[model samples]
Every structure is written in structure tokens, then in C-alpha cells.
Target: MTRRLLVSYLTLAALVLLCLELPLGYVYSRAERERATNAAHEEAEAIAGYASLTLAYQHPDELSAQVTACAERIGGRVLVVDPAGALLATSHPLDAADQAALADRPEIAAALRGGNGADVRTSSIGGVNWLSVAVPVRHGATLQGAVRLIVPTGAIADDVHQVWLGLALGGAGVLVAVGTVAATLARWIGRPIRELERAARTLAGGSLTTPASVTTGPPEVRVLAATFNRTAALLEHLLASQSAFAGEASHQLKTPLAALRLRLDNLEPDVPPHLRGHLDAAMTETDRLARMVESLLALARMEETALTPEPVDLDRAAKDRVHAWGALYERHGVRLLLLGAPVGRALAVPGAVEQILDNLLSNSLRVAPAGSTVTVFRRLSGISAELHVADQGPGMTAEQRRRAFDRFWRAPDAPKGGTGLGLSLVQRLTLASGGEAVLLEAPGGGLEAVIRLQTLTPRHPGGFPLPLPRRRPMAGSKAGAGVGAG
Candidate 1:
């Protein structure tokens, strides 16, 4: 921002300098050239008067000597010609071809015709630029001869160049001054805003105490800082209140629910056989209510916590969870398998991968039928590591999948004991770790829950890594055969 501001100031300064100095330079150059032309013309006219007297008296020697001295004084060449356009004397001697060409020259011809002539042109001989002036000699209305003076234009060009150089130097100096001022101004304006930005990030990162400085920048920025502080304080207060309410509610509800379950169990022994069904139904309802309360509390806790992401070995986590859930799957007569090879580490919030996997596996186990396979796998997709838990159970439709992450939302045909908060928890944990969770249709008919998390290296989409050649037995479990790499 500072660099941009400085460049903007310099650009504006350069434009202003161009507008002011370009015309000034052009006008000065034209004035200098005009002044030189006029001076040469006046001097040429004076020499023409001397030539008139020299020609009328027929003193060629004196005319030659005078022309030579006049050329030396002015650092130019001088020429005197008769009325018929014949060159009589020259300050500088010329070859036969040059002397022959002088009579037909435009300025000299014009002077012999009783008119003054002046022109600036490039010399055909050496490609040098010259300013030439010619004036006729008159002795009381009788033309005796003409005088022509030629000077190089390099001196005039040198003066104009110096002026342009000075203007450029002045513009450069102005840009430097503007850059320094702009940098100072940018810092003055941007410092408080930067502090405000840092404060905002800190608040988002779960630090509610830090506030932007309100005394440093411009008045508008100070006001913004003050407003940010007020807003942050209010948000912090609101979250604190919410957390307190959740904690208090959890404490107040769990004890009563436990006592109610205990009392229902106590009544089961006293109730007769016919009323036992009614008692059992009551207990079931109570259990479902307790699960709902637990789910709600878990969601509340998750919302209040802000966890930073860290690297975890995705392949190792998947294997560990599959091993843990193997016995449960065997008890239901369903196969739990870990597919794919070992993918590298992925970035996720601490304990987030474990919690997300637990919820997904629980959901899959609930919906999976006897003799059906529940597969867990990890693969690399682009720069993300993907973990998929697929179950051979009834899959949801597009509409159900779209709303699956909503809190307490369940499909119409979902299992009876579900609290409908598992998917929601999975999605929340994934997003908090800067990842994504989605329900995709599994191949050969079922639901596939895919979680994508960040990885340090990029990977191309390809076939899954080769599974292990032999099955490895799980510890303290006879269901090892049901849990092999696919």
C-alpha cells in the first residue's frame, strides 16, 4: 500500500511537471533561435554597408581583409558578392565546385535581387546544420553588392538541450520529494488500519481481549477502531453468556435424566408382565432424549472451541479407527475393511480427525446390513488428503444429502435410535480444520462420506494405492478376517 501510494504521488508529479515545463522549454528554445537570427541579420546588414563603400571605391583588398576580420570575430563565414551574383571575396577560401555553387544559392540570389534572406538548413557538404542570413548593399538606391553570413546551429541546440536537462532534473527532484511525503502519509494512514486488521484476526482466532489502538491514525480511522473495540466486546460477552448457559443446562439436565432412567429400571421389577411393554417403551424414549441432549451439548462445545490445525498421519488414523471398530462390526455380522495404501500426513485440528472418523463409522455401522462390508480408505486428491467411509446401506437422495449437515436433520427412513447429529458434527469438525465433508453415492449402491483435508504436497488423481498383500490380525479380536485391506 505504501509503494502504491508513493508511485501514485510520483506519477501525478511527473504529469504536472510535463504540463508546466514542456511548453516553457519549447518557447525558450524558439526565443533563443529567434534572437540569434535577428542578431545575425543586423550584423549582416552592417557588413553590407561596408561592402557597398568598398565596391564603389573599387578597393577589393580592403573588402577581403574586412570580411576576414568580421568572420573571425563572429566565428562564422562571410561572403561579399557583386550585384550580378558573382562572389568577389570570401572569409574562407572555397574549391572551384563550391565557389561555382554559391552564385546560385537561394539566400545570395535573394540578396542580389535587393531583398534580405534568412534560412536555417542542413549543409549538403558535411551534413552540419547552418543558419544563413543575407542582406543587400545600397548606396542611395544603387545596389553595389550583397553580404551573406553563415553560422552553425549547434550552439543554439546546446542551449536548448541544457534547458531540457535542467527541467528533467527539477522534475526528478519533485518526484523524490513527493515520494518521501507520500510514504510518510501512507504510513500515517495505514498503520492504524493494519492494527485494526490484526485485531479482527485475533478475535476470529478466539482471542477476545486484544483491541485496536484508537489514538494513532486519522480521525475516521480512530472512529473505526473504537467501533471495532465495542463490537468485539459485545461479541465476547455474548459468547461467554452462551457458553455459560450450555454448561449450566448440561449440569442441570444430566443428573435428572440419569435418575429418571434409574427410576424406570426400578419400576420395571414392580410392573406386571402385561405393563412391561409400556415400561420398556418409556425407557426407550428416555434414552433417546438423553442421547439428544448429549448431541446438543457436543455441538455447543464444538462451536465454542477454536482449534488450530496440525499434521496427522491420515493412513495411520484410518487403520487405528478401523481396528477399534472391528469387533463392533463383527458383533453385527458386518465386515469392516480398510482399503487403499498409506497416504501421507494431512493438516487437521487436534483430535478432529479422530472425532470425525468416530462419527462416520458409527453412522455406517448403524445403517449397514448383516454380511455387508463397511470400507474405510485414504487417498490423495490434488493438494488435499481424502478419507472415505463407505457402507453398503440404503443411500440418501440428493435433497437428503444437501440438508444432511443441518443440526438434528435426519432422513425420513433413517434408523430409529439416531440423534441425527453425527453428520452435523462431522461437517463442523471438517470445516473448522479448513477442510470439506460431503456425502457421495458409493459405487455398487450405498452412501460414501468423504472428508478432504489440507496436505503439504500436491498429488494427482489416480488409482488408489495397492492394498497389503496379507491380512494382519487385530489385537484382542477374533474378527481380524473381517477387517483386511481391500
Candidate 2:
């Protein structure tokens, strides 16, 4: 059993043994039978020579006596019969059972028909196997009676036995030895691989420790170990550097942000209205900077928190947004068309669905032309929900569209401009909440923005939870204005 486990090596060794031994065994078996038949023919020819002239005139009994003597010398028996099929052998007394073996045998019939013959077959008497060889005793090629020799099958059997034993014993021993060596080698190779597996898994689990050394193995394993160690150290160093930078950035930014806020507070009420608006714009920029720095600080202190996500119904959130913005849409003389709602709930951070709609609504309200159609479509199919926010306004040119969602870009033709972060912030929130926002050209003209999100159902278990929508600039836009399709 211990040896059998070495199939990795034993399989090859056994195949080699089979390849070498089978043909030799076949050839050796054939030669054994041929040699025996050749010896029988030679002995029969010698006896015929001895009695060639004398047995020609002698009675059949004397001929049988001489032929029997020749066969017995070779550990076999002999038979003689006339052309009339009358048996006349007495040298070895023939039994009634032996008559049947001689009659049906092809070798016997050949000799009777004036031809030499030989065959090896199992014996019927006592079931001992035998080979029969027949030779014609001829006088000038005239039909003389035949001498048939019956040799027991012991010679060929012995040859087969010896050869088979040698092959089996030798083949088995070689296989066993080869198997033992191969198993040892396989284990030696596997040990390092097993160690590498453990080390790799450890690194994946966020360890900065050095990997297990690739000792006593192939050159590849050694090189891989060195590379792994270097990469882990590099990542650790980079993370530490980012932590220090975030700390310095927050301190540096706070002062400028505070000064900008203080400058806004000190604005004199006596200042002209146009100058006051400029001062307000500067304060907004400062506030945006402070917000960015705060976001960076949060990223630096981030941990792998298991945020369990739950389904959110966008329909309810949209209805609420329409209620909130009903007065505004009315004042703009633009209808809010809330089209078909999707069948399933959307997957979002607690208030992400609300926030995303708010941004789309805000952008739509800002750009929508009075008396033009504005459409909001909520669709659900194939385990996902889509929120389409489209408006009939001057469509963005290709170049402008490319930069439409940049942090500070604004369309030159937009009547009511923004700090460009509105759409960008919506994109950021959508991505972090495991959703996507796509902007495309509307059918007639304007923008077709589709928000595809996983629906709240048992479909995705324990996914990320997004932050709730807030009234803040970026956070406020996820809520949509109910721009009805007029």
C-alpha cells in the first residue's frame, strides 16, 4: 500500500516494464513450441532412415516397434496406421480414448495425406497438453505409411513459466524503488509551495510582515519571495506617508478656510450689492476647499467597516422631492413629469437615492427652458433599477459635455451657473454607493442622464451602505425635482 501511493513514479516504471517484457514473452513462447516440433521431426526422420528399405517390405508390426523406440527416447509416444486407416501400433499400447484425439487432429490428417505436419494443442487424455508431429516414411516418394509423434506440452510450458516469473519479479521491484524516490521528490517540491500559499494568504489578509523565505527550493520561488517582501514594505511606507500628509493638509487648509469665512463676516452692509455678490462667491470657494480637505481627512482615517445595505424605495423619495419642490417648479412655469416608476426598490446608502435625485432635479431645474418638457423615468428589470433624468434645454456641445461634470467647469451659455461640483459630487456619491451615472444626448436635444443601481431586494446580500443624502452642496443633489413631462 505504501508503494502504491507512489503512482506518480510507478506508472511510468510499470509502462516501461510492459513495453520491454510483452514482446519478449511472446517470442520466447513461440520459439519453445517450434524447437520441440523440430526435435520431433528430426527423430522421426532418423527412424525412417533406419527402416527405409527394411520396413518397406517388413510387416507393419515391426515398423511400429522401431518408430515407438525413437519416440520414447524423447519422452513421447508414437503411432502408425495404414493408408486404409487401420491402426497397427503396439510399441505404445493405444487406448480407445486416444483414437478420438488422432482422428480429429489436423496434424494427423496431414500426415495421412502424404505431408509432414506439426501442431501444439492441449491433450484430451487426462487433459495433459501435447504437441503432435507427423513425418512420412517414403520409398522413392511412393505412399508409405506414416509415423506420428506425440510430445507432451511440458517443454513449452516450462519456458513460459520461467520467463513470466522473471518479468513479474523484476518489473515489480523496479516500480517500487522508483515510486519511493518520486514520492520523496514530490514532497520536497510541495513543501515550499505549501509555505508560499500560506504566506500569500497572510499578505492578502493585510499583513505587512515579510513573507516566508523561499529556502531550499527552485530559483523562481526565491525570487518571488524577495519581490513580495519589497512590495509589502513599499505599500506600508506609502500609507504612512499619506497619513502624515492628510494631517498637514487639514491644518494648512483650516486657516485659509477660516480667514475666508471671517472675511465674509466682515463685509460691510454699506458695500454695493455687486461687490457683496463677489465677496459671497469668494466665501463659497473657501467653503468648498474646507469641504474637500475634510473629505480627505475622512479617507485617511477610513477603516474596513461592514456596512450592511438595505433596499430603498426611490418612488417614495421622488414623491417627497416633488412635494418639496412643487412651488419651485410652478414658479419656473416648467412641468415636473414623474414618469413610470420601476417595479423594485433601489440599492443605496441610507439617503443616497434621495441625494442622487436631488442633484438631477437641481440641474434639470437650472437648465430647463420654460414651457419645455422635463422627464424623470424610473425603470426596473433584470435585478436593477434605472433613474432617467432628462430635460429639454440647449443641449451641451460635445466639447462642453466632456467637461460638464468637472469640479469647477460651467457651461458658458448656462443662465444660472454653478460651482461645477454639483454634478461631480453626484458622480462621486453614485460610484461610492455602488451605482453608475451615465450622461448622454437626449433624443431631440438636451441631456439624458441614467442612474443604474441595484434594487433593494434579497438579490445582493449585505452590500455597502451609502451615506444618507444631506442638504449640503454635493449631498443635496441625489434628491430629484419632480420635473413632469408636459
Write candidate 2's Cα lDDT for 189-277 as tens digits. Answer: 66666667777777665554646675755677677767777877776577667766876777788887888788677775666987988
Candidate 1's TM-score: 0.88
- What CA root-mean-square deviation does each model show from the true structure? 5.6, 8.4
Candidate 1, residues 126-198: lDDT per residue as tens digits? 8888899999889889988789999888889999999999999988888888888888998998899889989
Alpha-carbon local distance difference test for all models: 0.82, 0.66
Using lDDT, give the best candidate's number: 1
> Residue 469 of candidate 1: its Cα lDDT?
23
Off by over 4 Å in 1: 57-61, 124-128, 456-486
Q: What TM-score does each of the candidates earn?
A: 0.88, 0.61
